[model samples]
Target: MIERWLPAAASAHACALDAVLFGIHWHMLLIFTAWLALLVVILIKFRQGANPEPRPTEARRLWPAIAIGCVVIGDAVILTTLALPAWSARIAPPPANVTPIEVRVTGEQFAWNIHYPGPDRVFGRIDNSLISASNPVGIDRDDAAARDDIGLLNILTLPVGRTIVIQLASRDVVHSFTLHEMRVKQDAMPGMTTRTWFTPTRTGDWEIACSQLCGLGHYRMRGELHVVTAAGWDQWMKDEQVRLTR
Candidate 1:
């Protein structure tokens, strides 16, 4: 039922996070039912209609303590067993023997700057002084490695069935890079770089939203996330390279 309303899970980590969420909801429901049952029992046993006179002294019962303990135990179980495992699985180092696609994402007032290292797989130097309307990422095009660098605004294209490692940062203020379908949300802060990795399990196009309220234009801050098949990705890369070299 919970999965029905959520966006399609397009990444490996999405299912793991969903499992944790489902467990938490079930635990909450059980606790609510237990408390409601206890309330009903108390009302029936101690009501004035049932007992004409009430005693000043009350008998100590173990059930209340047990119920509280159970709640505590349930929380601990969820934190250690379900939540931690899912978090670790997503944050773990890239899988062995897998070549991950890496990209740099920088968030500004109302846009996401997409930087892709060309075939060299090495990003070029970024000079803060070179930042302008046309050059969002401040790439030094004269550099050999930067000659093939691809910079796009509000568009990120990735390949399916592969690990994606993102070096996230902010250009001005704090912003959350949110990918709903991919189960990815991370803060991109200024002057600091944060690394996040995930493996895409399906192919689809989704909206990348800025979950954080950065400025007045936050509502209009949106980007496109495209996960395509291997062949499609290869062709896209080839076209981009040809266009750049031409």
Candidate 2:
């Protein structure tokens, strides 16, 4: 039943995340069932007709303490056994031998700004003072590093089976960068840069949603993420480089 509600896992790390979520939901279900059963028992046993006169409660404080203790233990076990380990693995640095595809995502009022460091693999300088409607990210064209930079609006393309690191920021307010298929979500905050990484295990298109409410147009802030083959990625990069130069 839990699996039915979950989005399809498209990233290497998504299965682990889904497992954690499944465990949490199952735990919550069990707790809810136990509470509901107890409520029914208490209501039936303590009905007005069952006890003609008010009596001192026989319920001991020990039971409540034990229940609270059980809940605490359950939470501790889930955190230490499932959540902590998964989080540790997620935040661990990528292997030195693997070169991840890096992209910069900047959130605005109603759009996502996707920036790729062209063939050089070096991000160019961005000047806020030079920001304009046309130059949203303020890439200084005079800088050599900026010459081949590719700036895109609302489209993120990456290669399957390769790790992708996205440096996230916001131009206006806080926005959460969410890719449901990838099981990745991070807050893009103004004046601060955050990062999240994932390895695409499938080749397809997915929605990139702003999970946080930032402004009046927050509901419309959306983008697309396309995962393609390595060969396709190479061809796309070449085409983008050519387009940038032109």
Candidate 3:
């Protein structure tokens, strides 16, 4: 319901997002209602003709102290009950049995570089000057990891149950990597790497878009993420391998 009304700007950190939002929203609604009613009552009860004399100044002074107290205490509870747990879940330790798949994600002037670790589970060094469709990862080819890596742009996919660790970096300015259904979004910054992880429970096609405005072609800097069933993902990988070799 929150997603439909507020619609997450992108995928949220995890399931914890909704809980935190629920708690904060409930408190906010109560506060707003109380404040609104107080304002309405004051307007009606304090008309100039209705009262010959004003209330003592000391009585009004106490209102600010009371209101601030409520606000401060309310916020503390929200942070303790709502925000902290959600943040923890976002950066919590991965379980021991979880198999992590590594992918190097690089953002450039107007495109994305997705490098899949080859059979050796590594990505080869890239040569900028030799970039071409056939050499997507910019792999030296002689390098074992580059030789078998399935590299491409515009389209990417992941297996439904596998946990994916994305090493995000930017070659130019900043850009955001977001996947809506899985609720994972992170920034890609130049000279520093940011990491994001997510395990997709639902399988479907999703959008990979840049949330930040980078340049004239920012809108065009978009792609698709296809989450599939385990068997379907395996088939896609096999197809990619064949495509890379040919």
> What TM-score fits each model?
0.93, 0.89, 0.89
lDDT of 1 by residue, 1-246 (tens): 999988899998899899899999999999999989988988888889978888645447677789999999999999999899998887788888999999999999999998999889999987879888777788898899998888888889999998999999998999999999999999999999998998889999999899999999999889999999999998988898888767
Prediction 3 global C-alpha lDDT: 0.78
Return the clash pairs for model 3, or none.
11-183
User: Which tens-of-lDDT digit does each residue in 1-246 have in candidate 3?
Assistant: 565764343233555676677778888998899899988988888877887888776356677788879988988988987798778778875567977888888887678888888657877767776678766557677766577777778677888778888899998999998776666778999999999887776777877888889999999998888878889977888887888778
Query: What ranking emerges by lDDT with the best candidate at the front?
Result: 1, 2, 3
Top TM-score prediction, candidate number = 1
Cα lDDT, all candidates: 0.90, 0.88, 0.78
lDDT of 2 by residue, 5-120 (tens): 88889999898888788888888888899889989988998888998887766575477788778878888888998899899988887668889989999999999998888889
Candidate order (TM-score): 1, 2, 3
Write the number of the candidate with greater TM-score, choosing between 2 and 3. 2
| Residues forming the 10-long window of minimal summed lDDT in candidate 3 | 6-15
